[model samples]
Target chain A: MKLKDIIAALDAEVVSAEDLEKEISGGYCGDFLSFVMAQAPAGCAWFTVMSNHNVAAVAALTEVGVTILCEGVEPDEQLKAKAVGRGLDLIVTAKPVFEAVKALDL
Target chain B: MSSLHLEFDVAGNNFVSAGSASDEVKKTLKMLGVDPVAVRKVAIAMYEGEINMVIHAGGGKASVDIDTDKVKIVLADEGPGIPDISLAMKDGYSTAPDAIRDLGFGAGMGLPNMKKYTDEMHIDSTVGVGTTVTMVVNLR
Candidate 1:
């Protein structure tokens, strides 16, 4: 599925890279970085409220297809730029973390 | 066999920088044509160890040696060491403070998960001096 679908499905806002909605995949959710590193499959949509540059780094390392920031938390401009430069689809959702994950049908 | 060695200094209490070492190791392994599964295993195992070093041990050093037969990781920290290795190895056993938990870590799975992902694991630690973890993931 395209990233646009994920945004539409979850009623999320496109926080960055409004032009790159073509990149999307299955959803994976976890707050624990270690657990996500271990279990989050490569090339999948990742949903978390982790609001740090490290989240973008993890997405780069894990090759996550996209990142959905839940709970309406907005990352700083640096992180947003990093996400865009890394070609990651970044979105923001006002819904709770679990609800965002559920909307993805993961 | 000539080994590829990589070293990283993990910063104390820096959750944002925790995975930097693992990320570099993963990239190096991938460039060297290590098996993808083995790379992932080593990445996860070493990443967890790095996080533990930051959270519990006040940061430390991580050294990884990659050879034809195995990838070896050594993480050494100078914080308060584990009093009971076996107890600490159990799942859901954590001594990390609640503050670390708010960052989505300190779940007590660091040691257990490290052991789970590596083929061989050894931990040497003193209560006050420091802790050293050595793990080997065989490359078949």
Candidate 2:
């Protein structure tokens, strides 16, 4: 599924828009950075409440299609700027991690 | 392609620019047409090392030597060395303080993850002096 479609389905807010047409292969949820880096599949949509700037680095390294900040979490200014600079997508949603993931049809 | 070497100074406690070095190396590997799988391994392993440097060693020096067959990474830091490397290598063991945990790290997966993605790994450290980690990822 394309990122934009997932965003629409989840009612997510795009804070740092990259390639909305990018296809998300799947989803991985985690707050631990190294675990996410080691375990996440490339091009998957990452769901996390980690709003720090390191999230941007992990997403870029893992090549995640988009980052879905769940449970009303939002990226801080530094994180937002870093994601934008790296061409990584960042979106926010009020849904909890499980709910946000369940809403995905991909 | 000729062998290429890259080096970067990781500033300690600088969360803002923690992964910049690994990102640069990832982009360079991609541009060099390295295999996607190898690139991912190198990126993850190196990024983990970079974060470790920032968190544990109060910043460190990272150097990468990329040859046709493999990539060699060396991370050296002058922070208080590990007392028990075996313990440190444990999957869920970490010495990071609570502040680092709040930033979403300190789960004790950094070293294990680095070892997981690399073909060979070695560590040399002195308790009060420093620590150096060497890792290699084969491209073939």
Q: Which candidate is the best by TM-score?
A: 2
| lDDT at residue B139 of model 1 (Cα atoms) | 98
True contacts kept of each: 0.33, 0.81
Candidate 1, residues B16-58, lDDT tens digits: the string is 6778899899989989999888888888888889888888888
Most accurate candidate by DockQ: 2
Model 1 residue runs over 4 Å out of place are A15-26, A60-63, A76-82, A85-88
All candidates: CA RMSD in angstroms? 2.8, 1.0
Instruction: Find the 10 residues in a row with the least total lDDT in model 1 chain A.
Output: A16-25
After the best TM-score superposition of candidate 2, give how far the Cα of residue A26 lies from its true spot, in angstroms. Answer: 1.4
Model 2: lDDT equals 0.91
**Angstrom error at residue A75, model 1:** 2.5
Model 2 lDDT at residue A36 = 92
lDDT of 1 by residue, A21-100 (tens): 47566767877665666667876888898877767766776667778888898977767877777666688899987778
- TM-score for each of the candidates: 0.85, 0.97
Chain B vs. true chain B: TM-score per candidate: 0.97, 0.98
